[model samples]
Target: MEIRQHEWLSASPHEGFEQMRLKSRPKEPSPSLTRVGANFYSSVKQQDYSASVWLRRKDKLEHSQQKCIVIFALVCCFAILVALIFSAVDIMGEDEDGLSEKNCQNKCRIALVENIPEGLNYSENAPFHLSLFQGWMNLLNMAKKSVDIVSSHWDLNHSHPSACQMKELGVIFYNCSCLVLDLQRIFALYSSLKFKNRVPLTWSKRLYGVYDNEKKLQLQLNETKSQAFVSNSPKLFCPKNRSFDIDAIY
Candidate 1:
């Protein structure tokens, strides 16, 4: 009898469980579970794929642009470095041509003038002429000072009386009637004076002449004059190989 009772109790529980399962089957899945499944399916299909691709492309473009910018900056820096080096070399060469403190004595160039104007001829003159002359003078004077001497012969009657002071200041004049005179005669007078003073004189043949081999020689001669003056005149602090002479008043 006890065995039958145990079997009936187990059977009753099995039947009740079957009935509960049948009732639960008609209910739909939980709302939360259904939403989770839908989200997973949408992610797999990539419904917002267009927006995602756009964002990805934008990011890639930004990175590439940053790299290009870095490269351009490097190139600019390199160009600047090269330019600085070239400029330094040019400056060194120019400075080398100049006389040092040790050689600043006993060297000078001299210019002899014939019919110089009354006042100092320091004006550069018309535009272009003045610019070139002034530039050359600046280069020369930086190396030395005090031109040797300017001399000419003037017959006071024909000469501009204003030029008289020039003669007094070592600018000797012999046969000049007035400052208004021939250019060649003036140069000749200057050359003659240089010869007499025992001072080496150089000419800038192209003061207003053709720019050919002759012009280059004149410029070279000008440099030579500077050198001679520096070497010879020890009283002044100038190099032995720097002297310049100018026929122009400036």
Candidate 2:
């Protein structure tokens, strides 16, 4: 009798199939889940997110503390490097000012090895630039013992010029003036001046009479008369060495 009652209690397929199927199907979701924040939600909420989460923020300038610490570390390293450099310089010389004093008191390397570039900008502040041939000649003349060449390239003869092939460069005047004027501009008379004078100091004027072009260095005391006898000084471009002098004249 008990076994028959247990079989009826259990929903055996033969006993009550339709009634058991209806019980298994859900009528609706639980009220606690569908009500919203208690358990389940269809979409995310702003309040549910943590403060640490972020989107774009790639520039990172907002983190002032990290940037300040990095900058402070760099400044400390630079200060340390500067200190080491000064210490090394101090070790090189016995006294603090010894290195600087030696540099000021001496003139080294009378010989020159020049490397002037081709197609150089004409409107430079330089007095003038020599052609490649003139610079080579000058180097030969100045260097008796040894020549020290400092050059980015060795194509002086091929690239820029040998003797300034371009007539418009005014480079011939630049070279020839230096050669001739260095001779004409120098004299023993200038040695007695209280302030020492150097080469490229003065421009000279030569005057000759029309008696078959007789050559002489004549002295005329009158300033007014002297002006008429001498040719008007050549264009300032030919002789101007100092930028301030060129600027003032122009």
Candidate 3:
């Protein structure tokens, strides 16, 4: 017809060239969608290698529990420094045996007596044949009964003539019996020698007759009443104003 109708409008089958040949068609996959995309890319590479081996085994179990708490704090500071070096070597071995037993008890309590000579020489002013006035005239020639004489300074011209010759030699050689003489320290040495004019008037009437003989020997020992007199008669005499013959009181 007109050249066969212009070749049927130039092969009128051109629908935008068959959609540009199925948009440059190269797609050919379909073996059941290529086996579901190769099993979803091998299960996402085995879940990224099991999350990097579970974060390297949780960082090697927290570095082995911080090396067992720093080896139990260095074994408790080496057992408290070996118990303070054995308690400072047992307190320096008991202070060296208590300083060698206090230096042998201070060299056995050292002593030595005879080296006296230092001053007032003449062998220290002589006088010493067992003298404290010859041991008080050998305890007033070993008196048997009584001879008390409490003195304060009864130096009536040198200890009242050796205390009236030791009370008349303890009543004629130890037949003593009694001779008390306290007189209140000789009336305080006659009131300090009557205030130092050195009293006289017969020494103030012999210190008022020794204060009236110590008030009549304390009223004859409160009115004598005697008894107890066991005696192996070395002249068993008890009657001298007996009560309990208070040998010496004033």
- Highest TM-score against the true fold, candidate: 1
Distance from true location, Cα of 162 in model 1, Å:
2.5
lDDT at position 124, candidate 2 = 61
Question: For every candidate structure, what is the RMSD over all alpha carbons to the true structure, in angstroms?
Answer: 17.7, 22.0, 29.8
Give the TM-score (vs. native) of candidate 1: 0.31
Q: Decide which is better by lDDT, 2 or 3.
A: 3
Better of 2 and 3 by TM-score: 3
Candidate 2: segments with Cα more than 4 A from true spot: 1-21, 30-33, 37-48, 52-64, 87-250
Per model, state how many residue pairs clash.
45, 0, 0
Which candidate wins on lDDT? 1
TM-score of each: 0.31, 0.22, 0.29
Candidate 2 vs. true structure, TM-score:
0.22
| Residue ranges of candidate 3 with Cα displaced over 4 Å | 13-16, 28-35, 38-46, 49-55, 87-250
Q: Mind giving the per-residue lDDT tens digits that candidate 3 earns over 1-250? A: 9988888878777866898899999999989888988888888788888888887788777887788888888899888888656533334322212322123121111111121223323555664333244445656777666545543355446563444344121111121111122222243333445566533322222222221212332212223432121111111221122222243321
- Please give the TM-score that candidate 3 achieves against the real structure: 0.29
Checking candidate 3 for backbone clashes, the offending pairs are: none
Residue-wise lDDT of candidate 1 within 1-250, one digit each (tens)?
9889999997989999999999887888999999999999898668578778989999999999999999999999999988666633434321122432233222223333333445646557622222323433554565454333323354656543544444322222222212112223234334554456453333222111111121221212223531111011122211122222331112
Cα lDDT, model 1, residue 170: 25
